[model samples]
Target: MSSTPTDARLMDGSGLARRLVEETAARAADLTRRTGTPPCLATVLVGEDPASVTYVRMKRARCEKAGIRSRHVELPATTTTAEVVATLEGLSNDPEVHGILLQHPVGPGIDERAAFEAIAPEKDVDGVTFSSFATMSFGLPGFVSCTPGGIMRLLDAYGVDPAGKRAVVVGRSAILGKPAGMMLLARNATVTYCHSHTADLSAAVREADILVAAVGRPRFIKGEDIKPGAVVVDAGYNPGNVGDVDFDTAVTRAGLITPVPGGVGPMTIAVLLAQTVDAAERQLA
Candidate 1:
């Protein structure tokens, strides 16, 4: 029996992120006008890693464009875990700061989780804290990990409901994979997680109605693994602007697929700004 061919749709995350950023800018302006204080996002960078620096710079530029203020905290490469925690605690207590974002991979020596825990749950706009994870898992009203939150938003924009769908998340990192799975679970998707150690990764992926590739390895998910008509969300950002999934071939099979540069990257920052505004609004209330 010959199966009907599927014409895949490109999920335009860039377009959606643009609209979201515009809305966030307007809301930010309104909030500032009413409260006499602009929403402020505090960015904490542990080292001078070129990539991390660039990411923070981009975030600050976006905040400025959105009428939000930014407070930057730069630390030495050799900063200890306790020192990182102290800095975050300071930002957490600062009433002028509405949100806090700590750039990930704060070098090998530091205890990352301890530093993440230092940020107050209310100020954790990047949604890296355990509190945010729990809230997202339970479908509670709280900040969510920006990338996962953005993925959900994209799904909503494309009118793809996660309810009762099989979602296969490749990777189990705290910020990306784990949170993505939890968010899908909250939306009533039957979620499965696969990692480096999973046997038959391709088999797991082929079962997905919705596939989220966030394993951070370039072209790690092959096209043959993709189920026909599945919604594919590529959240990986590897070197040379490559995604975890092989987009070239996956696009042919996926009902909807997100491109690398224009997909999950833009949405991540858009969600951050939106959550920052939300944090400010809550503080004002």
Candidate 2:
């Protein structure tokens, strides 16, 4: 027997990112013209974790494409937590650096939180600092975690209002999952958070009107568990460019879904560049 195909729309994050990047580039150009100093984003990384290196490289490439200046600092794998903190502190104090991003998951001995806290609030473009989280949670005007910010943008672009929706966020990482649920809550959505430890996880997922799969496990969220016509945002980026949701089956059930590579990845970088420009503008103001 043949299964009937469902009519689900694919969210084009890459297209949205391109448009946002163009706007950011224009703002960067205008900022440079007015202040004679281009917006600069400094990236700090500890160790040569392949993922971290790749992320920095992608960010740097995007920065140049958007007319934003970039400074990169890569520390040794043996770097201590204190050294990492000092490095971030130095970047935080640099006059030329409008935004500072300390790539996380430092060496095994490093305290990631301590390193994140070293970046000043005003310059925390990546939104890893507590100050940023506080403002974001309060719905105040401030920097946001880049990936979450991007996810919100995607929702808006598609006219998916969170108000009164049963939004379920899988995974509770500080930057992506936690901030996303908080932002949705600020928008009046009834939010539920689920992690690996969440009992009866599939049941919680099925109750969601808007599902954000961010567990970082490839195809961890089965398509059958997705509520019919629910909007799905797959935030996981596993190896082989796969997402947490099984798109093949999810596309048949969800009203809207984001594809793996062309979905959240580009938006994350786009959000970062936009925040960098925002930081520069605020500093000059």
**Could you estimate the TM-score for every candidate?**
0.97, 0.97
lDDT, candidate 2, 1-285, per-residue tens: 123377888899999999999999999999999999999999988888999998899999999999999999989998988898888889888899999988877767888888899999999999999999999998888899999999999999999999999999999999999999999999899999999889999999999999999998999999999999999999998898899998888888999999998998899999999999999999987
| lDDT of candidate 2 at residue 248, scale 0 to 100 | 84
lDDT score for residue 80 of model 1: 99
Superposition TM-score, candidate 1 onto the true structure = 0.97
Candidate 1 total steric clashes:
0
lDDT of 2 at 26: 100
Tell me how far the alpha carbon of residue 195 in candidate 2 is from the true structure, in angstroms, after superposition.
1.2
* Backbone clashes under 3 angstroms, per model: 0, 0
lDDT of 1 at 201: 90
Candidate with top lDDT is 1
